[model samples]
Target chain A: MAEGSFQYITLAASLPHLGALFSNADLPMSRYRLEERLSMLEDEDRRRLDRIAHVTSWPGVDGCDTDAEVVARFEAASRSVQAHPDLAAVVRERLETRMLVAALRLRRDGAADPAPVAAWGRTAIARAIRTNWSEPTFGLGRARPWLRAARALCAAGDHIGLERAVLTEVYRQIDRAADDHQFDFEAVAFFVMRFQLIERWQRYDATRARGRLEALLQSTLAGAWTAGNATPTGAGMAGSLSQ
Target chain B: MTDLVLVLGWFGLFAPVALGAIGSSIGCARAGSAAIGAMLDTETGYGRFIGASLMPSSQVIYGIVIMFSLQRDPMTAEAAAGVFGVGVLAGVALLYVGIRQGEVLASAIVAAKAKPEIFGISLAPAAVLEGFAVFALVFALVLSGSIPG
Candidate 1:
């Protein structure tokens, strides 16, 4: 639908509430069903939404062979979502967030400076990160408060904590955009983005992790199952990975 | 001036019904769309949603009543003034209330769908809007009695 013609009361109302982040263990609706509902959108709108998703979701950039390719795809996606101001803001924040988190990870991994990380982020932040390489928040802590806590999480060797903090910040950004819209394309786009986050969170469930481990075990261990498998494994890889 | 007053008399005579219809239609359509959308997500309680969507229709009913109360057997300059004042003002009130009522009802429906327990309390705002429309209707009828027929 056109921007102003988006009377999506029915469309938005049809979708169930996604509640707070990490509040629900499972998605209110499945990806397939959500896609079916979203098919009601015009082709142009759907394409715009896809572009927005490409910038924010991991799978959107999964096929890129190099960082430059990813950056190029991100630029294109950012342009496509410009028509939606709220969503444009969301895309912008997501990019900055990804840059900030990546910088954190690289620094944690013993990168000496932000010079290499500067190649992929915005111009404004490239200078800040590069100049503040020795600073804990890279001198943008006040502007980006989440970065301070995120930096602390990285230093404390809490990768899972860092992941949680990053996801929460991203979720809040989308949630803020969502508050301005109720029955429009922006609402749908925000809903889909939040759904992706919820799905990712659910995938971090212990049951799902156990299932994945079993599948891997069946392949590598040749389906071997000892009776001791029923006993406590003392916090296996699945335990730490479960959200 | 007399002819203009007579023309306004006719305009005022029909204003309530016409304006009310406009308001009701807008309100009903807004809430009705929300109700339909809510139905897709829900299995039961369709009746309540449909019923809530009809809340805006009362604006038209009040408009019709105002029209009847403002009716004069033979339009005159003196009666024309009161008719125009009461009927037009009443119509404007209904129109505004109807549109606002629709918006609130739509919000109520959406909120209630998320939390069903709030459905009853959610209608409170729309009900209060109905009270305002009734106030316009009641006073217009009272004032219509004083017009020089």
Candidate 2:
């Protein structure tokens, strides 16, 4: 695309704002602390992030407190990006992987059947979307191998390893997508996503990484009572490269 | 007839200036945006940023030199044609190089902002574009000597 074209300009303008959206979700920091950190960014950067956040946030969804609600929030965000099919696919893939891992964790902890894990919402439907028959084998199948890795990590009680595996996988796809489509708008989006991912990953204190892993496992073990906790703090593998 | 030769000679004399100026303006402007964006991310290193942005400005200087070299007291039709051909082609070449070089500089600025240590390395591509512009300038200057005055 020409540099000054609408699509190119829009993609360029949207890139800096992604800093906030994809920032490592593995941290347990408070929203206020996140806001304080954001305040230090350039005015243009701050404004763009705020504007995108405002647009994407649902009207009545005040603080998603359950796995179902969190999934809903992700779905809403994914739909918001539907104007760009490649981005929508990338985002949807990320959400699906998270859902898969969370379900596997629930199954490992107590739940015998994974089908009704989120009866309050259409978790089954979301799963179906992720495992659709029409998609590429290696692309969608990549998540399955990661799912197996997550299960193995859970079996071994390797919380840190699980976090590292899942997050790295999520960004692996994004980074690959970016590299594969170097000249497209999706490449810019992928680069920005990867940037945000790295920012968040770096910000997490390496020394306290184990404690964070314990926190994640503890919340997972708490079952439905603690499922909502994962929503705020986020649950995933991060900083695998750091280790 | 004499007036036409003078007119053609004047056009040849100024062609590089017009084309090179357009290129420099566009290139510098493009690079300036990236430099300005990067300066916001760092407090120091403003000097390097400014220096990078001015990379395209050299095209205009080349244009000016070519304009002066093309000037002659008794300009002939053949000489005027030679002047117009060399000056205009060189100007056009410089114009393209300047704009492309600016884009390269802009990308370098973006990358350097992300990782400050890559500042020097990021300039490599822009230097190559500048080399192409230099090649055009040198050839124009050398060829001007052969044109009948």
Candidate 3:
């Protein structure tokens, strides 16, 4: 291990529980079960989760009937998580993505306030996103493509489709970096982001997810064929036909 | 003069084991930490994780082989210098590559835990580093033969 490198420890302490901490449970008593699991995490992680729980309580997501209140709680939780440097980067990116999606949906419906989406303007996330454009490990490359997709989706009034597109891209990023198995901060960060996306998709709209996933798969295969990289074979043809 | 020859020969005999062991120790420690973390996330793959953790230990084996090859009767100053040079340099190479391979394996283990499909592909980088260690081992063996016994 490199001197002064406690990166693996940080990752080990944090990554496994991200899905449980942020996921919206569908099962009966799952929230209580998740809370029990959260309690068992090491102190550093437990503190971060406690902060998020407090924010969630302020305008309890289920208690909030309006979309505006839900967005507010998201912002508040995102804001509070920043005090813990270890959790800040991933939390910020997650919140910004949700905010951007909410903003696009609201704007499409001619809502008066786009303020929630613009919340990132004053945050450190904006600076990080600006600085690290090509870095998939740091969650930098996601912002630009997400914004572009958000614009196109909002124009089409496909509000629910935002998550599927974002998640598809997240999965693709994970695939691209799957071979980057170095035990550094970057590798762990990528894992955390990938885990978060997997959990996010678990509760997303299934019909939209299937449609977007199929489209993504087609485009990817089409790209392979167009680039003359796809092996011309019976199996390839059959695979394409099955899809 | 005779003392100098014996001294250098002693250094040559132990250099590979010392350096190679250091490298392997660091590598195993790094990769082992990752294996423990991966185990925490998922169960029933302990065997593969343990196998991956042993990748760095190969460098030390190479070091031991080179040490045996460098052993010569009636050690002379000229032969000892050749042995010392080949042994120390090759040991250093093995050491460096082992540590690097460990880091790569650690990453591979964590990445594989998240996406098991990439497990085979993730091992490529570590295997490439191991190739470097093999190159060092082969060169040391070949150079040992050239030294006049």
Per-residue lDDT tens digits of candidate 1, residues B38-125?
8888888899998999999999999988888888888888899889988899999999999999889988998999899999999999
* CAPRI category for model 2: incorrect
Predictions' DockQ, in order: 0.57, 0.18, 0.09
lDDT of candidate 2 over A1-243, digit per residue (tens): 442433332233223323333344443334454454344344544443443344223332346676667667666766765655766667766666666666556656776544544443554435453344223221344546666567678768888688777777877777655554532455544654565455545554454677777776555555433544656542322322223
Report the Cα lDDT for candidate 3: 0.64
Q: Predictions ranked by DockQ, top down?
A: 1, 2, 3
Query: What is each predicted model's overall lDDT from 0 to 1?
Result: 0.84, 0.65, 0.64
- Model 3: runs farther than 4 Å from truth? A1-149, A155-157, A163-197, A204-243, B1-9, B37-45, B72-76, B107-131
Scored against the true structure, residue B109 in model 2 reaches a CA lDDT of: 74
Worst 10 contiguous positions by lDDT, candidate 1 chain A: A219-228
How many clashes does the backbone of model 2 have? Answer: 3
Model 2 lDDT tens row, B77-120 = 77888888888898998899889887788777767765689999
lDDT of 3 at A71: 54
CAPRI category for model 1: medium
**Stretches of model 2 off by over 4 angstroms after superposition:** A1-89, A102-148, A154-157, A174-243, B1-13, B72-81, B110-118
Clashing pairs in 1: none
Question: Fnat of each prediction?
Answer: 0.62, 0.00, 0.08
